[model samples]
Target: MTNTALDQALQTLERATSTPELVKATQALCALNDLEAAKPLVKVLGFNNPAVAAVATQGLIQLGRDTIPILLVSLDARNYGARAWVVKVIAALRDPRGLDLLEHALEADIAPSVRRSATRGLADLELSEDAAHDQLVRCFEGLLKAVRDDEWVVRYAAAYGLEQRLNSAAVSAHLAEQGRAALNQLASDAEGVRVVQLRALKALQRLNAG
Candidate 1:
């Protein structure tokens, strides 16, 4: 589509009162892949509509690295829901630029859901570790800590991460030690909510079977 055509479509998206109109505009913007669509797509992430949010996220990911700087800045957005969505986008991109931000959010974000998303980001990353293995160890340790987080959802996410990786042949001894200890503790968590403990127990079961 031409730049003028893209701009008009985005304007229609902004003014869209009905779902069909919004979806059409969203589809147009996704097809356009113009840099100008980044801000509007980011705004769509904050919308209460899940369909719009999914479309915007896919569009932004298709736009690729151009969306990273905008997303990084948006991490500071006042709306926690938007921040949560932005983190998921960054996680999907798997850009190293997002690693520090993801780690910080995991450690400190006030929102459990944001922290939950951050765990997935950290889990799926392949960081360039130094000789001391700080980066790799940090990622593992962060998941370990998150497995015991106050929120059951956060714990569930952490357990999910460990569960998926329990049998990987490539796991280093150090990382395995960290993951196993954390999983074992989570598996037997006396005070955790039933679902959280169940996830932990399942992860441990998977580990044993692996």
Candidate 2:
């Protein structure tokens, strides 16, 4: 598409006064997939419209690594909704630059949904062989702690994260064992939510099968 199309979309998004207008504009911007649209999409995240924010997220993810710097700096401390959506975008990108933010969100974010997304993001980070050792340890430690989160969703995500980390060929045997132990604990937590326990059990089974 042309820059003119992107410009029109951005104008529409900025001028939007209703949810439908916002969704339409955001969808248009997303379809453009222009790097110039990166900042605008990030701005849409704070619009407080889930439909619009979701579309903006898809647009940002479509922009890929070029959106990383924009996203990293765009974190709004006070806007939990925007932060949550931004975390999802960062997770989808799986860029190493997002690791710190993902870890911070998983460990300290007030939103369970954000924490859950962060858990998956941390687990799915694409670490190079040289950087995998320390970064993987960080991811594993964060995910292990996440297994005990107050929210069942976060715990469930943690179980899946641990399983993913364990499956990585880059994971050391020692780290793999620790991850398995964490999953085992989640699997047997009779007091925990049944869904979470089931997720943990499934993670364990997958690991054992591999």
Q: What tens digits encode model 2's per-residue C-alpha lDDT throughout 141-203?
A: 889889878999988889888888888787788888888888888889463699988888898
* Tens-digit per-residue lDDT, 24-132, candidate 1: 7888888888878888888887776777778888999899977888888776457788888888888888776777888899999999989999888877765553532
C-alpha lDDT values of all predictions: 0.79, 0.86
Model 1's TM-score against the true structure: 0.86
Query: CA shift at 19, candidate 1, in angstroms?
Result: 3.4
Clashing pairs in 2: none
True-structure lDDT of candidate 2: 0.86
Candidate with top lDDT is 2
Return the top candidate by TM-score.
2
lDDT of 2 at 25: 84
Q: Residue 43 in model 1: shift from native, Å?
A: 1.2
Candidate 2 lDDT trough over 10 residues, lowest sum: 183-192
In candidate 1 the C-alpha lDDT for residue 102 amounts to 86
